[model samples]
Target: MAEKIIKGIVIDRFNFRDFDLIVSLATNFGVIKMVARGVRRPTSKNIYILNPGCLGEFEIFLARYSNKLSKLKKGECFFNLDLNDKKIYAFWKLVSQITRETNFVPKIFPILEQSFAKINSKNADAIKVYTIINWIKFNGWIANLTRCRVCKTNQRLINFNFYGGMECVYHQNPKPFFRFGRKELEIFYWSSSNLNTFLEKVDFDYIYLVFEILKQFLKQNSYIFL
Candidate 1:
């Protein structure tokens, strides 16, 4: 067997037999689970590089069996997210979970890499919203927010639909499971229009609420969520 070098970010890790670790790495090739033999030991050289949020180039040994995960030999970290911060860690955990659960969609790794680069304290929440929006769009779940899917009118756009059309929640004829008001409507408008303006103007409270709902919707669609 020959050593193969690959570059990726460590999305997650689980301890194996007290001394080893199984790492989920998001790479250009897609997410792959590899065994980091003896990484749980304090003296292991790959310990820091094989943990979550670490972006590194790894040398691995390909498994002889397709069902078995490859072996993580050694690696060097190029960037590392500060997992010590609970909020930031939670955000990243959601991202990794999405990668783990969602089917292999083309170009998602690049989007994830771009998303990680955009996150910071100053614009973390905004970036998170933006990233989720992209994920929703990429997975073909985002519906038209500019107008009513049935009536084809932008007026009274209050209800949410996960299947591609949104109805009004205020009307008595039919009730919608996920609905939004004028404020949320405005947020969705900017989300569809200008991204920069959306990030700059989105209210924290509304963004948080919308984020939660969107995440739930993703979960309902068999995607990943926090």
Candidate 2:
């Protein structure tokens, strides 16, 4: 079998057997699952490289079978992101949401890589994270968060249709849906603006609210939350 080295993020992991693991990784090529032999052993060198959120450089042996399961031959940590407890939880929440919303591995590996780098950065704010997510959605790749689909206005006082898109106050009715106040809209706009400005001045509270809104939105769409 030909050996290959690849850079990837540990999106998920599960025990395969006594001392072995099956890990789901989002790599530059695509999402792939690999078996790591003896990874659970106390003295295993690969144990440190198998953690979720860790960026790794891995040596893998591709199998001949059509199922595409690879064997992890070796791995090394590229960067062990130093996230505090609160940040760690936030990171996990974002990852969970992303994995659920997306079916296939994204073609934009740079975006995913940048997200990981931002989440790991010491200077990253909660609002920055929120904005990044919104940016992705607005780009038409994830979800819609732009003008009201009905009213066609960019006003902040908006209602989110359960199906998708936003609605302005003019189109608002007694329909069962989620609404965003002016403040939330301001936060959303600020977060989704250019990356540099967002990173410079984003609030934790504002970002937290956006996160909750996104969670609810995803829930309404029947996405799994972890």
Candidate 3:
């Protein structure tokens, strides 16, 4: 077996047997599950590295079936990510949402790592963290939240048709389509902005609203709530 190290975020966990855990990790390669024996026990030396949000250097011994599902030979915590209680919960919520919404794990790992680093930073702004998440949803190759799919307009009051592209209210029947509010549009625009100053200046209410909108959008399209 070849030994290798990979950094990842624990997206989900399930108890196996006798203090062991099966963790689903979102790594740069993709979503991979690994068994961490004895991780649940208080005396387990690997306990520190098995946490949900911790970015760690996992030493994996590639079993023939490791690519399918197997246990790592050993693991170590590279970054424990000392976060406040609120931030920790928020981080976990974001991770859970991401895991639920899409299967494009490999592509999202870089963005996830960046978000985690920001959340763990001493000067990290909660609003900025929220903005980063919203930004990725809009700009990601998979989602592409910008520009109406039909008219390709950058207008705020977009008419969302799940199958077709977004249409401007003027271009479509207003009653049937869902409208993304001005504030919500601003949040998306600001989230995708290149200026770091805008990220820091976003209001909390708008941030929360953006999250709600994205969650609803995901639910509408994929029947999944993030």
The best candidate in terms of TM-score? 1
Each candidate's TM vs. the true structure? 0.68, 0.67, 0.67
**How many collisions between residues are there in candidate 3?**
2
RMSD of 3: 4.8
Q: How many residue pairs clash in each candidate?
A: 0, 1, 2
In candidate 2, the residue pairs with backbone N, CA or C atoms under 3 Å apart (3 or more residues apart, or in different chains) clash, namely 148-166
Order the candidate numbers by TM-score, best to worst: 1, 3, 2
**Candidate 2, which segments miss by more than 4 Å at Cα?**
17-19, 38-43, 64-66, 81-84, 100-112, 120-176, 190-197
The superposed Cα distance between candidate 3 and the true structure at residue 102, in angstroms, equals 7.2
**Model 3, C-alpha of 78: deviation from truth (Å):** 4.6
lDDT of 3 at 187: 51
lDDT of 1 by residue, 1-226 (tens): 4578987888778888989999888787777778888877878777877767877789888676657799887898887877677766766866676667355554466655655665666666666676666666667865675666666676766765656545554432354556676666566656664456666666666777878777777677764756
On residues 77-120, what C-alpha lDDT tens digit does candidate 3 reach at each position?
65555546665665565566666525344655665666665554
List candidate 1 stretches off by more than 4 Å.
Answer: 1-3, 17-19, 101-106, 143-162, 165-205, 223-225
Clash list (residue pairs), candidate 3: 149-165, 149-166
Indicate the residue-level lDDT of 195 in model 2.
48
